[model samples]
Target: MSAIITVENVGKKYRLRHQKTETYATLRDTIVRGAKNVFSFNKVDKPTVEEFWALKNVNFEINQGDRIGIIGRNGAGKSTLLKILSRVVHPTEGRITMEGKIASLLEVGTGFHPELSGRENIYLNGVILGMTRKEIQKKFDEIVAFSEIDKFLDTPVKRYSSGMFVRLAFSVAVHMEPDILIVDEVLAVGDAQFQKKSAAKMESISKDEGRTILFVSHNMPAMEKLCPTSIYLEHGTVKKIGKTEEIVNEYLIATNAQ
Candidate 1:
């Protein structure tokens, strides 16, 4: 398999937000403070901001037909790396090179239109995921059938049971047939059955269809079953990268120690 994605010296920075209590009741009071801050050296005249690097000097490459799992504790930059790969956020430094169409399910209902019916949202999501309207039309039935939302297709997604909404969202995302797929732990929605189905579909898409998949999940057993490779991140860095068994064991042991 050839290199489908390459990430070089990638880093992400985020400003620490300090929410100041508002003392003014109206715009005039705020304006007065702003004017005073322009020439004043007093500490109260200016607000201070702090910044931190989320990901630093991160680098990796993924080949075609690879199913890699991203495993880490919370705030470990797993999602941050996925966001960069999905183009949801740009790195503060370095770059990413992508060779094929990429579709990401970073969250459930990410591209869904709440007011629209499930049916309408399907087409909308498909188009947003880079499919043409005609392409969506061609896969319309398959999408609905796979989602099992045929009966409630025309009902607004806002009215859907959480499971129905997740089904519709996951179905639309995975059906895009992109050469590269990035999935976060969005299968937490719906029931156990839906999670199983989604995992199966992802497995077939990556393992059988020769696509590259980057998966993030806390379910170690599921990761073992579905993914062949694992990348363990700790403190915003790749701690270990190798066969799923060894990497997952490292993740579990480290997390338990913590």
Candidate 2:
């Protein structure tokens, strides 16, 4: 099988405002901004910006039927790289070639309308993740069953507890069945039982269904259980790329250096 995803010399840069205070100068700033928008919306230029590279010269290939873990410390660009691949943010340089439907769970409860009922939001999230109405309908019952929120399905997500919201959102994401699934550290929420079930679901998606999964998580035991190969990132660069054991061991060594 050909590579399902190829990332070649990819780089992402973010221009950071030197002073974040200027972005939200004061409560009056919003009124001024609103008035400016009512007019021609002329750009007000005052804040200085510094370019920061979030991902640099990052090249990797993801074959079909692979579950790849992305492990890195905080501020190491793991989240930024996932956002780039998910199209939430565009990369500043290089090229990425993907040959399948892609769904990204960058964060739990993403792309949801808070005012929508859980059932309605499920359909909406499924559609946004590239599922057809027919497919979503087919999996509707299963999604609800897995989420364990049948009773609250009719309630607006804004009224649901945070835990309930995450459960429903996670269920929708898993049921969409995209060929390439990208997840970013969303296993932190939910009860322990749901977390275990979600892990099993992800493992099945990779091992049984032969999907390509790029998982970013700080949970070492869960990462070890799900990913046999991984990429370790450090300071916006690829620190190591190999077996999960190898990369994780290297990460341990590097962390101990502190």
Candidate 3:
């Protein structure tokens, strides 16, 4: 099968400012500092700007119906890469080509309207994911059932707890049935049973419906079980991409060596 997603020389750059002061400053301190800086002739207190690359020269290809795991330690550019793929942010360098509709659940309340009712947000999120009203209506019942938040269906999403938010968001994203699903570690907020159910659902969609999935998680066992092929990222770069078991092993060895 041809590749459904291609990432070529992808990189994301961010600016970091280092201030010559206490890391945490109160409002009063900030105001006083600003006044002093404005009146003083010296620029020694000015923050130094530096460029930080969250991702660098990352290249990968994902085939249709593939379940791929992205594993790494904190600050490995995992979230940045996902945001780039989901079009939430643009890469500073290189380009990405995607062949199908994509739905992403990168955070608890991502793509959700906190002021809208759960029922309303379902339609909203579905529409955002490229589904028609009829399509969303067709799967609305299933989404509610999967989320198990039927009682709160008409309640504003702002009233939801983190777990509830995740359930509703995950439910909507999956039920919309986008061609490509990009999931970050937000699922870790759910209960164990819910996580298991979600894993099974993702596996089913990829295996039975031929959808492509990119999963990022720190849960090793879950990652191993759900993804046959995996990419190991370290320090904003791809360290290895191969069978999940081998990659996980290598990552673990390196992590333990540190």
Model 2 TM-score is 0.87
TM-score winner between candidates 1 and 2? 1
Considering lDDT, where higher is better, how would the candidates rank from best to worst?
A: 3, 2, 1
Task: Give the clashing pairs for model 1.
Answer: none
Worst 10 residues of 3 by lDDT: 16-25
Error of 2 at 104 (Å): 0.3
lDDT of 2: 0.89
Model 2 bad stretches (over 4 Å): 19-21, 24-48
lDDT digits (tens) for residues 1-258 of candidate 2: 799999999898888877546554687876775666677556563456789998999999989999999999999999999988998899999899998889998878777998999989998988887789999999999999999999998898899998899999999999888899999998777999999999999999888999999999989888888898999988898888899988888888888899
Reference-based TM-score of each model: 0.90, 0.87, 0.86
**Tens digits of lDDT, candidate 3, 29-133:** 778878889999995466787899999999999999999999999999999999999898999999999998898878655569899999999988888777899
What does candidate 1's lDDT look like per residue over 135-220, in tens digits? 78888888898899899988998999888888888888888888999999986667889888988889999878999999999889
Give the distance in Å from residue 51's predicted Cα in candidate 3 to where it truly belongs.
1.6
Clash pairs, candidate 3, are none
